[model samples]
Target: MNHSSDLISGAATAATGTQTTSPEPPPRRRLSRPERERSIVEGAVKFFAEVGFDGDTRELTRRLNVTQSLLFKYFPNKASLVERVYQEVYVGRWNSYWEEIVADRRTSLQERLVRLYTDYAKTALTWDWVRLFMFSGLRGEAINQRYLGFLRSRILEPVAIELRAELGLPGPDRVPLNIQEIELVWGINARIFYFGQRRWIFNVPLESSVEELVQLTIEHFIAGANVLVPRIVQAQIDAAPAHAD
Candidate 1:
């Protein structure tokens, strides 16, 4: 069995390409899944981490010391493996975290967002394949749509409704935000995802570490949301005077 060095190179190279120094994933926890599935994803993550999303399946099998059929028995195809690995690496823990945060209202919405950023930051530092899919995710429409829902239901929806009631504001009215507000929050999230994940993918400047990015995002959102809410309420009140009978 022989795997090309480019096995983890293709998609990464396709994105920004050609780096001399590369890092490897730390020993992944065995808690990943059943042995067969865990082995498949861990290998897949290594390939994506080393080569990138476009890494060749043929090389993957060679590295796995398995036939294509054997590989497919677990993952089906390259894209399917990428999806499975993505879920195992990034999505699984995150969804579990979602369950915990969703039930807790004692924490502020901003706190929940920061917790998420911090979690991903830690994962990016230790998990190689996770960082790859994060970068690659920006390109997939289906992933993007699902990602939006993940944000809306798990974080934004609960927070928005709570904030609206707390401030004595009409629910999602001109007082503060609408559906578009979720996209604004997504922009902040994109920054956290971009720089953290981009570090391994493009070897971009880590002018700041992962935790710093998460902290900065949390701080900025707190400061900005405060300012944004008032302006929205003012706009509504100013318009109210004209509408009065």
Candidate 2:
């Protein structure tokens, strides 16, 4: 992941009457403002992911082979450029229609969960996305939090509702999510996220293909949910303070 951006050539020194090291210059290219801005941001994503958020903008410009001033013209600063990278990578990649797909009652709950994850893993399980996500997490970046919020509101909540429905329990709109139910769904969701981390970040060998993994995970999840939800709902009911008749 390291790049030539941080390298300094130790060739010569004039004061010592000895050769001084000069880093090799980046290749020159005549790109328009929009084109060059795009290029800088693209390079910055890879550069930041490799060296991290603390990585120098000078190195980033070197990687882009552009003058620092030119990069500033578009981004003003590294933070601004990082914002665009977040927007491009995290926000832009979101499929708005995923909610609809997940909420489609025509599909069985098991089928919906599997399909939702299959679509998610296809796009979000890449090395760049996972690495950037981990990097942002370490930096306490809000973008990753926002993405998680999106997942809860769109993906996780819907699955919870569907899970309850599949077991003939009341929806969240009625009984709402009990602690046990929430934990149940979070456990399932966490396993799916870890699957991506294991595959991409850890480079673990997966015995199941993406499709097989999704199907297997959801099937097991649904099996557990069917048995757990009723017991959880009863526990919640018993825990409620009874009113005097």
Candidate 3:
């Protein structure tokens, strides 16, 4: 009896069966140029959000399972990549209708503000958005400066103009929006923005719903603005030196 040879043959047969049954991994698909760029930007957004602007591109590529050369092929440099992320996270999410909403005279200023903040929070209060903004600010990146400039011009300045109209104060043409007036609008935005910071960055539990909090904040601002804005403008007027005839 050739028992040893029989055993060797059975082992070989088992190995062959295992190899035949094993599934081969599917081949990687080559993405189109636009598709590749889009993926890199998307991955960078998430990577920067998790680890801030200082996150290494090598680690990012490693996480994405792509070569670093591929990333640079889409983005010339890390700065360009970060810029794309800023556009995607901040500018891309901006609703042009918000400008119209602020300018819409039919809606009361308070309601308009409430709607603006509520909608703004919904769009800008995500984990990626909030964290990336804070990280950029902390790093003194241009992302924060650029976005805040847009906010000041598009939103804060317009809101200040609207508040002047609401309170019967002189328009920007008559009395340019002073820092105090601008800060009043900024305060409202800052409060709403801080809510996002609390929820997303700090990982804190909010005491109330976003809708309730936004409404409450806007209501309080309206109440105070009615009294304070008039007083502030009057104070500014009084502080001005009288011209001698």
- The model with the greatest TM-score is 3
For candidate 3, write residues 114-192 as lDDT tens digits. 8888988888888999899999999999998899999999999999899989888988786667888788888888898
TM-score of 2: 0.81
- lDDT, candidate 1, 16-44, per-residue tens: 86767768879855443377677777788
How displaced is residue 97 in candidate 2, in Å? 2.1
Backbone clash pairs for candidate 2 read 9-21, 10-21, 11-19, 11-20, 11-21, 12-19, 12-20, 12-21, 13-19, 13-20
Better of 1 and 2 by TM-score: 2
How displaced is residue 107 in candidate 3, in Å?
Answer: 1.6
Deviation (Å) of 124 in candidate 3? 1.4
Error of 3 at 85 (Å): 0.9
lDDT tens per residue, model 2, 1-245: 55544342232233356654798999977778788777777898898777778789988888787789888989888788889988888888889777888778897887777778889887787767877888888888776888888777777777777778878887776576876776776776677767778976788977778788778878888888888888888787687788899
Candidate 3 stretches with Cα past 4 Å from truth are 1-26, 240-245
For lDDT, candidate 2 versus 3, the one ahead is: 3
